[model samples]
Target chain A: MTQLVRVQSFSVSSDGFGSGEGQSLERPFGSLDPADLHAWAFATASWVGRREPGGSRGLDDYFSRDFSNGIGAEIMGRNKFGPQRGPWQDLSWQGWWGDDPPFHTPVFVLTHHLRPSFSLTDTTFHFLDASPEEALATAKQAANGGDVRIGGGVATVREFLAAGLVDVLHIAVVPITAGRGERLWDSPDELLDRYHLEKVPSVSGVVHHLFWRD
Target chain B: MTQLVRVQSFSVSSDGFGSGEGQSLERPFGSLDPADLHAWAFATASWVGRREPGGSRGLDDYFSRDFSNGIGAEIMGRNKFGPQRGPWQDLSWQGWWGDDPPFHTPVFVLTHHLRPSFSLTDTTFHFLDASPEEALATAKQAANGGDVRIGGGVATVREFLAAGLVDVLHIAVVPITAGRGERLWDSPDELLDRYHLEKVPSVSGVVHHLFWRD
Candidate 1:
């Protein structure tokens, strides 16, 4: 079976920013508050490490539940892994998702400074310094015929999109605007020629846009 | 009766830019093509001065027909009128819209370099050098108890939105991106606190977002 490369439930501001600037230890979403960008996901019952039991079981919940449906391996940017830039300061910094991360499959972390493979729970983190095609090749191998998810922090998604490697991309446009941050694409129209686009608005005031390549 | 200020059938790119950079007479939408930004409206039967008779009679058609509904006057930036900057060298330049403009109502053209009022068919162009509040006051009077439409070129809409003069704003977000241009608002979140926002996705792959004040 051909492995499908997808971006599921990725959140972006109405202004097209995926994440804000000035990322640090204290601020994971940078200067912008996490609640504003992720209220829809947090309100859903399928959110990773959800605090409470009761949450909205609407369209947001449906999309959130679809996040981990069929993902064999996950590929994420260096920033999404942690805020530590350049060479890793301390090897102790595993990830923001604590000991048991959400992904039960093997996770590939794209970084210039490579590190030895490590595992926490069912998820294992492998650091690789390679191009998008090279990285995807490794990820597809690790996926074991299952789908490979392009988990993003803006730049990573853009890289894969620009390379035409992504088969399906689901962008959840939150109503909030991130004044400053890394934009997903300079113009999303560039993708119109390559893929088919569809917009689905949810009751939670969030518009879910899907781009797929047949 | 109190006058209502609205933006109807306004189309924007996925990145929030209404028009692209370096707008000119030849390139009305700058680097971007009008067909890309307004394909949805053109596909509708209600498009003004539509060359063809047959078009989609769906949601896009409904919104296109609503553009002129009870609109007594229109307030638009000089850019929306034409591309002439500084002062108008040619007095013959009426507007981008030929003989009969779409707006039959009194259209207020916001410009620093003022000119005498001119009329084309039922639509009369009135030049005004004033702030958002002052412009609205003038447009309201001309509206004659009917709603005043805020015809935009991005900067104009942002001004009215910033001044809190807009009552109902309907923005149709097309899947294409402009790449560069004047953006409507830095962040739409500013309005979230004051107004009610709703998103409706159409079959045309366009997301219609409505912001209304109660």
Candidate 2:
């Protein structure tokens, strides 16, 4: 049988903008030192190599390593594509990776715009104009037997979650708050009972919470 | 003068069982294969170090190191606290970090239940039975001059975001779709327009999209 799964997600804060204020783009994450957040890095598995002398090691390292398991393809949204507005131009935007991108598998981008197949050194970006269900079907096929992943600009994930399509959620709750902007988890409180807590840890003071269905 | 900021958030896929399956406490992240997901780790600055054969270095290493900046203090919800049901069980649950946790700083937990000023090694877990705003106030004070971080179990971050208290959001768009679970972007579409794209990339196929508001 085909088993579906959801990964982890969390919210980031932004400063409410003033009409006079320009896009400052201040990275509040920069307030702490890279070494200080070693714990969160470990949990998300976003960490790669050692930064300083005693960079990332030990349990943080263990969890960081644990983050990269399992499988298949990925799904994302256009707002996440880049600063570009309107329809996707071409494969020229090969993502933020310089040359050799990370994902070695096929990726499905959820978009309203119709675009042709785009390829990178190790990955292919296929545009999905259909509903999320259609996208999932394609991603699953592309993933083969592995598992289909959902990459989001929020809307995409929300669409799936509303349909009860996610299996697991590993969220790294950062220790920052934005007084304004987009909100996550505004649904009815009854929805809270759908899942149970799996793991919760303060990695380098960053809260890494995991949730799953009973 | 204190400056208020907006919240920027995106969603990512988790394994399955956001918190865990019907509540099976075993392997929360679920059987992960280390080799295939190396890219997911490389993008978020969430991973630690070592494990990969040629391992990871440079910008990939920066992914792990970048998280250690600007955080002064942290606040989290019970969801981010762990799978414990009910509450007030003593200082026994000093959090999953055990003693001498990775976070050598002060951490505040938003909870209905109260516990003594719990201390694990260098980190102190302060349980605040207060609203998100109140928690932010205390966290800011604890943060000194640095930024206050709000760690979440989902609802917590949503609460803050709706209140417009978050400042900077860094999201790593993972490649996976959950056929069922909770969502982060159920908010009205007009609310999300404030955030403009900051960065994006395709590493190992998984696209890492970061967003922020000036």
Q: Which parts of model 2 are misplaced by more than 4 Å? A: A1-214, B1-11, B14-39, B42-55, B58-63, B186-191
C-alpha lDDT of all candidate models, in order = 0.82, 0.51
lDDT of 2 by residue, A1-214 (tens): 3344555333322221101111122322233222332335633323534233233332233345333334578777764444344666655665543455455678787767767887777778777787877777788888877666665545566678887877656555455443443344542232467764433333255444455564
In the order shown, the candidates' DockQ scores are: 0.03, 0.02
* Residue-level lDDT for B71 in candidate 2: 53
Q: Mind giving the per-residue lDDT tens digits that candidate 1 earns over B1-214?
A: 3467889889888888888888889988898788999999998755876876566544565467667766899999999999999988998889898999999989999999999999999999999999999999999999988889999888898888888888777788899877788777655565789776766778988987767765
True contacts kept of each: 0.05, 0.00
Q: lDDT of candidate 1?
A: 0.82
TM-score: which candidate is best?
A: 1
Give me the candidate number with maximum lDDT: 1
Real contacts retained, model 1: 0.05
TM-score of 1: 0.51
User: For model 1, which pairs clash?
Assistant: none
